[model samples]
Target: MRNLRLTLAWAAALLVAVSPLVNAQTTSEKNLKSDKKAAMSKETLPRPKVIIFDVNETLLDLAPLKSSVGKALNGREDLLPLWFSTMVHYSLVETLSDDYHSFGEIGTAALMMVAETQGIELSYDDAKTAIVTPLRSLPPHADVIEALKALKADGYKIVSLTNSSSVGVETQFKNAGLTEFFEKRYSVDSVKKFKPHPETYKMALADLGVKPEEALMVAAHAWDIAGADNVGLQTAFVARPGKTLYPNADKPDYVVNDLSELVKHLAATKTAQADTESDKTLAEQLAAQAAKSAKRFPESVRKVYAEGIETVRATQIEESAKQVGDAAIDAELTNWNGETVKLSELWSEGPVVLMWYRGGWCPYCNIQLRAMQQNLDKIENAGARLVVLTPELPEKAKETAATNNLDIVALHDNGSAVARKYGILFKLPAAIVPSYRDKLKLPEYNGNDAMELPLSATYVIDKSGTITYAFLDADYKKRAEPADVIEAVKAAAK
Candidate 1:
């Protein structure tokens, strides 16, 4: 009996000793899994894409090229256009064929071709120095500094990219007074290849510690945009006058005519980011509710409005337009024509088309009015009355209407008081005011000399004065097309 009890105690001691090892193994496994999960959590987090600006045509103005090339070719400015065209074309070819060449090489080739055609004395080295040196000294576009400052203020890490070597890039930035505007400058020198070559872009991004998806390449060249887009980098095309966009091919995520437009787009994108987060939160709430009551309802309907909130917020277009409609706008005073017309009075019978014009002095406004005049019949047929509103004095407005041959009613909304109420009026920048006053010859606002109304905005207001459709573009050169107006009118009719 003594031996049996001793053996039993030994067995219990043995079990106790082995049990700790098992528990230790289990705890170690649990810790390993937790560490793995933490590592994965970091890996899954998304990083912000680096926004890269192409230094040449995007931020810098190349108008100096005309005179520079004219001198290089000995008084033939006509050869200027062809040189730039061929330079861009061959650059793309070099990249597309998986071959890399410096921008200087392409520029030399283009200049030689132009020299041969024009019978000018030019050598490869001369062309290279002229093109590359000018690039190092070109001025930033008028809107560049303000726009860049705004982007930097908005917490976006700005980068400058160029086919030039890092040395060349630094010289360019220093000359343009833009050195402080960029966090970093990426030159193709490290990769020893020009852009459009995936290696060049990839290496630059890798150096920045960012992935291609988290980067945006801004350029004025369509091929540059296409190449950037191909490699998974978002693209912004700055449509400078000498440069154009590829409308059909791999379109850029954003197209802006100038740097200011890009800044505005970025601001809008920031707003959209907030909107998207709100939408995601709403979706999460709905999903949680759906999970709670799985058996009571079918999956699809339950998924849509599963929460206590019965209404699913959808983007309502014409419905929202009809609900608020547009408010009746009127001038506080009448013109020399003795017409004191309430804006709503015109729309009561049919849809009233409203156009805001700056003045006759504005070439952009003139072009827009001409476009509207051309589509007068279309406007009339759409059961809409066309009215042109201007902050200009009555006489100036009349002169503008006569010059444009507009049959539409002209209403004078002096000082843009009505415009201020509608949230569209803004003071002209100090820089633009002097240029507009001296160059465009526009008179000052009645109340405020420093302020002026915008170029033009067209709106389709329903009979109830609610704006069914509105076109508000800050750019003067662009206007709502006749087709868009017709569509808005038809949409309102339905």
Candidate 2:
């Protein structure tokens, strides 16, 4: 009964719409509690791979349901706030007492308790009909659909976690036209536990194979944010009508008045991050990478690689390689799946960024490949495609693709024939031959004992089959940067 008084106090505050959760001004302002944290609040939110949303007032408009619940309380429409708070409070009580009941059943029980307290004679059956009927047919708010579509288009995995029963949310989404947006929907019935219990969130994380830190929980209820924040997931608070953060809980990563605001914040943060990445030039990136990798290799191996780089520099091999204004070579090769690929046909759509590397065994190649892949989207957005040429066997090329988690189009240039056509092919240094063939198993990877490689080269060719840009480097450590290639691609596009 004591706890019930506290619940009613919160309900009264919510009914008035005059204060933050529990009337503490804000759960956020009080939770700061220190100067450093308040300052750190200015930091932009880190991007999340997946977003888990709470369905009730966060996604749906609960205002329409008040009429039905009000009808049960003898026309006392305002008591709807008290009934909701009571239902949530009792759900917590049910969990703490080691008992289990579906959320709908608990809602009915809460409605009965509210009526009994009001001195109104309401039967259990009447309470159930009032709460359960309107709950399932609630309409979604105005700001929901567009924000959900924006999130999906940006490649975020969206799912719902609701205290409502499975059939309950399904009917609501179906009625509200929200079923098409979510990849999945979860109900507390799956774990037989209500939310704010920690286990409910954990159940979803485990099922999705997502780490807590990799997910963001978005909810209108402050208690829902509290639960997710304590468990190490990123949180976003949606300040819907009558929804506020709990005064004692940690501040959410984002606090927005609607789902549209949430999407705007995310877009701004991503643009800021991209700007930060753009500030560093690719040459500076490679030099930093070379310095870091230099420490990982032994003196003997490093000496051989250094000598090989110097030898190529002395020979001036890049001067004879493919250059801007040259007619692009048309070479037929097999992709990782053993499908034929022609450079001429590939660039017919727009432009193609063709890069050739020795094989996956070369650390330099691996580093360069990863760097380019990180900017693959940017390249494509510039109206170009990227194709990687490697002398490794198709099977080994497929293995490399999987290992690096790269989705770039990779083709196997079987005997370095394409490299020779580009005039960038070269024989492996004698000093590195033994280790390259025996220890690194280069022969098996390429299905040959030719002991050869290519001067790391990249070319941007226009749709007319003319090489618009070329990057040829004799010093293996000095590969072309993706940033430079993007610029060249932009140039070629004109």
Candidate 3:
């Protein structure tokens, strides 16, 4: 009994000694969470592949529609919003009940219901005319066109996904001059559903061939944002006049006052980390490799290599080659699997990190390819594709891919044809060409007798085919660091 009492006393003493530290840790975590929640209010969302816009009231102004509805409701313009709400409610009712009605018909019914609730006489034809006519001819919101133009120029896929019917949205867009802005316009009428229905959003994602996370639903209605959020899509809430967020719904990724402000946030280079730190750059490693390899070669051969590099530099090929801000040409090249891959097609899905390798025989090229493979995940996570081009035959490209175990795209730039277009193709040193032909078997590998090869260049091209980053060098040993390319991809996304 005495021993038990002593052990209990020890346990109590230990708890007392550690209580303060445990309390401090808990308090710190709570404060950190509090700070994070506060910061979220000012945070902007990441860029999405497709921006799905809600048409009614979100892009189009409802003031004219309101006046028309008010005239039908005995000059009670305040009842216009109520009629719209009733219309939306009935849409949900029809969807859940497995019944379908055109949005115009529902709107007409809703307006009649509102008129009856207010003890006013209304006819179906008059209500239909009031709702459909004004809704079709409604003017676009003031901030709509310029913001849409900016996004379209940036190569963002702009889609209009709305509760309005297909014919209704078509008429509306044509009348408002918005048909030119949208890549596609989808309507709930196709699925016979309402805005908050999950299937409506799913149908769009399916048709567009995009994952839910790749799309952002922008709307003025809190309920719509809630539906999109629940469906695993990022959402933006445009707090237009008289529209407020739902208190119980999850907060949207963005809460902007207008589309113009949303564009500004999307354009900010928030993810571009130019100073992203690393232990060593690929260029530095290449320098180290060059120095080490020099010991293996004779002094005469080393002198020849130096002259070749200097000679190429004198040509100023870097100035003539495609650089940043240039439009990337759609070079249709075949991959190791004999699949035709076009640069424009690749850029359509995401930003591309296009790299040129001399051949698998070069030690420096192998080193750089391995480094790029290691950083492949980082590049892809930033929403970019890594495409490695080599002036080797399709079978030789396969060998290189197998040798390095490279799982990403490896393409054959047959005959250095694509390289010539990029202005990076150059003749080899006359002294070394004979030895390279015999020793490296360059002619057999590339299926050409021309002693020409492209520079070890790298470029990052955005979805619009605009080159956002380029690395050109005469020295074959040097390469663009993968970390910098990843940063460039992130910047290109903005």
Best-fitting candidate, measured by TM-score? 2
State each model's CA lDDT, in order.
0.66, 0.80, 0.81
lDDT of 2 by residue, 1-494 (tens): 56657866755554455323333533432242232234325433446657999999999998778999888999999999898988898787666556788889989989888887888888989888998888888999999999999998876879999999999999999998999999999988877778887788889987765556558999999999988875667889999988778888778889999999999988887666445445555575556557644544556878988898777667767888888999999988888776887788989889999998777666567657766877999999999999899999887777566444467758888799989888998887788789787767888889998988888899999999999988888887778889889999998888
> Candidate 2's error at 338, in angstroms?
9.5
Q: TM-score, each model?
A: 0.47, 0.58, 0.53
Candidate 2 Cα errors over 4 Å, as ranges = 1-46, 280-494
Candidate 1 on 28-128: residue-level lDDT in tens?
33343334334323322112346898888788887787778877888787777788777766665554444667777778878877787666778888887
Q: Which of the two, 2 or 3, has more lDDT?
A: 3
- The digit string of per-residue lDDT tens for model 3 on 1-494 reads 35535644654566567658645644533343333334333333334668999999899999999999999999999998788887887786676557899988989988987887787888999999888889999999999999999988866779999988888899999999999999899999789888787788989987865556557899999989977876667788999999999998667878999999988776662232111212457776567557645644568988888899988888999899999999997889888777898889889888999999998667688668867877888999999999989998887777666545467668889888888999999999888787678767788778889999999999999999999999999989888989899999999987
Best by lDDT: 3
Candidate 3, which segments miss by more than 4 Å at Cα? Answer: 1-46, 269-494
Arranged by TM-score with the best first, the candidates are 2, 3, 1
Error of 1 at 245 (Å): 1.7
lDDT of 3: 0.81
Ranking by lDDT: 3, 2, 1
Query: How many residue pairs clash in all the candidates, one count each?
Result: 6, 1, 0
Clash count (model 2, backbone only): 1
